[model samples]
Target: MDPTNGDEKKKRFQEAFERGRDGHVGSYNVWLENHGFDPSRVDRDKVTEFFRENPTKSVNQDDVTDIAEYAGFVTTRQDLHHIPVIGPSGIGKTQLLHTVIGLLSEVDDDIDTKLLEANRLGKKTEDGFLLDEYSRQIAELTTPIVCIDDCGLDKRIRTSLRELRDAVDAGLFVTTWTPERWGVNQDQVRDVFSPAKEVHLRSFTQSETKGTLRVIYDYISQDNFALPSKTEERIHELSDGIPRLIHLLALESLREAYHKELVPGHISATDAAADRLNLSNASARVQDLSEARLTVLKQILQLPDERGVQPGTLVDELHRDKSTISYHLRELNEIGFVERDRKGRRAFYRVTETIEPLVQRRISQEAEYNA
Candidate 1:
């Protein structure tokens, strides 16, 4: 039985207290061990501190410190409020929000929650239908918290953000957005989430990136396959602090090594270079794109490493609509010139390293001609 509910929790705590007070150290130690505590660890206040500090049984201290802190505040705060975790794509924004919700559930089993997806909110018609279904979903929810994962991604959701402000005022809405999109659409953010708390997550640091690489290394090395000396450094440089790219490149490298039938011992730098070369060749396919697609790639190339533009930004930059921008981005993705990452609803499209130099050379030539 779950001891958190009904009389079971009270009985357990009371027994622990009684055992501690009666000088029954042996019994108390057993109780502590049973509860996943160590009696050897000394504390002045005993089990009370343990119960207080560990309100949520699971706490992940590393790899997501910023995420954990924000989640902690949202779950423990007395007043229900809106929280929008803003960051770049592939940084685990959605996963962090869900983790918080799971931890909160441990304390309040009755905490009501629901997840609302923007794109699937309703179907479109020629005359443009109203978001009646969306209104009804928020209105009828018995849950105290309603999570809107991808806030600015869909046109319908972006347009309806103003309407959801009331839900935020009521402290029931949680949303996410990519920093680039959020910056481009500041007006929507200001109007819809005036009082919302925003948490911005940056890219991973070198140590963290190395740690991730170690995990990959350990996995491939289990088969006695050795990696190059500077393999981790090489991958970290190529990935540019983006976690998804790190995993993607690492997997590709492993696959290439296996395909070459290289002797099991040390994976060569040549094998690693082969993986990068393949990426470059795949990106070279962008030359087959039309002028229209090339225009989109040009703008994407100007974006910083591990940074991308949202559909709205692309629309504004290219003077196109959402559908057009999305279409071109998809094409760019298919050709490996641009890679897509999601923060919430916003999909950020950044040019891959394979095509970066080509785009930059074009830009330089254009600059010289204009000058």
Candidate 2:
């Protein structure tokens, strides 16, 4: 249909919606009802006011701007582009993407934004009509932005990075995934997207952690919660620059302060919360070894015979620089994932039993599935 006819239909729908006087009657309304939210109790005006008050919605504007620029550069679209932001969970990836889309939509009335979780797409096992229709709508719409949340969580659909590369080639398709699982097939990923730009996001710095904590406290308390310089330093040290950990520590400290009716100044708290947060975040970083380290692990696990090759012999077989191999070996040894045996003056390395299965599985997956 022509633009005029489409506009007329939208106008008619609005008129009918207003005249009903009963309430909004549509799929969105139905969704609210199913989720146990009473449509009548939801005041549209209040929702608008809430969103206006929390414009950034827990996301930093600088990160959003960076992603927008990167997306534009890759998509070659002057106005908009789909960029995939990869990071660990609880690092505010989704928040950043949503903030950017909201900002872009505000500037251009013609742009439409749609958010879909990868697991909910028609790519799942128990498929539904809702997902099918949603995908169809996405393909049909001329929207400038489409954000797919948790793209790597759907193990079935994210089998290869090509699935996402194809989407990028077709149009803007922004997605987010954890570093460990961004692309399904790791070896084939580089082959599919030659020189694809990788934007690595590190945990916050000490200053950034302190700043984030201050912001959270200010937002929640509506008052400046003053702390001694040493207290802030301790918090930063304990949180280790992870944003989620910083937020948790700040909130926990605040809660303790509130419970005790402690004054805003000189608040003393235990570091237990920070320790727990660090333990939780550490697992996300476990699989993030460097390529050189992974190559060494693969070689040790893939050797045909039980008699593992010596470090020098393995270096010669792989035709890698001696220093590079040594660097990887040292890293693996430090991590306690590999052990070295001394044969005279020569060092022979073998995989520790704990990580041996993991290395073997990774190698087999890369050879069988990635190939």
lDDT, each prediction: 0.55, 0.55
After superposing candidate 1 on the true structure, give the runs of residues whose Cα lies further than 4 Å from its correct spot. Answer: 1-80, 122-135, 140-143, 167-169, 214-229, 263-371
TM-score of 2: 0.53
Clashes of 2: 0
TM-score of 1: 0.52
Instruction: Provide the TM-score for each candidate, comma-separated.
Output: 0.52, 0.53
Q: Per-residue lDDT tens digits of candidate 1, residues 252-344?
A: 553344445443222463346435644433324544557788778766643433457777887887899889888888877776677888998
Clashing pairs in 2: none
As a whole number from 0 to 100, the lDDT of residue 295 in candidate 2 is: 75
Question: Which residue runs does candidate 2 get wrong by more than 4 Å?
Answer: 1-62, 70-82, 122-131, 159-170, 183-196, 258-267, 270-272, 275-371
Displacement of the residue 256 alpha carbon in candidate 2, Å: 3.5
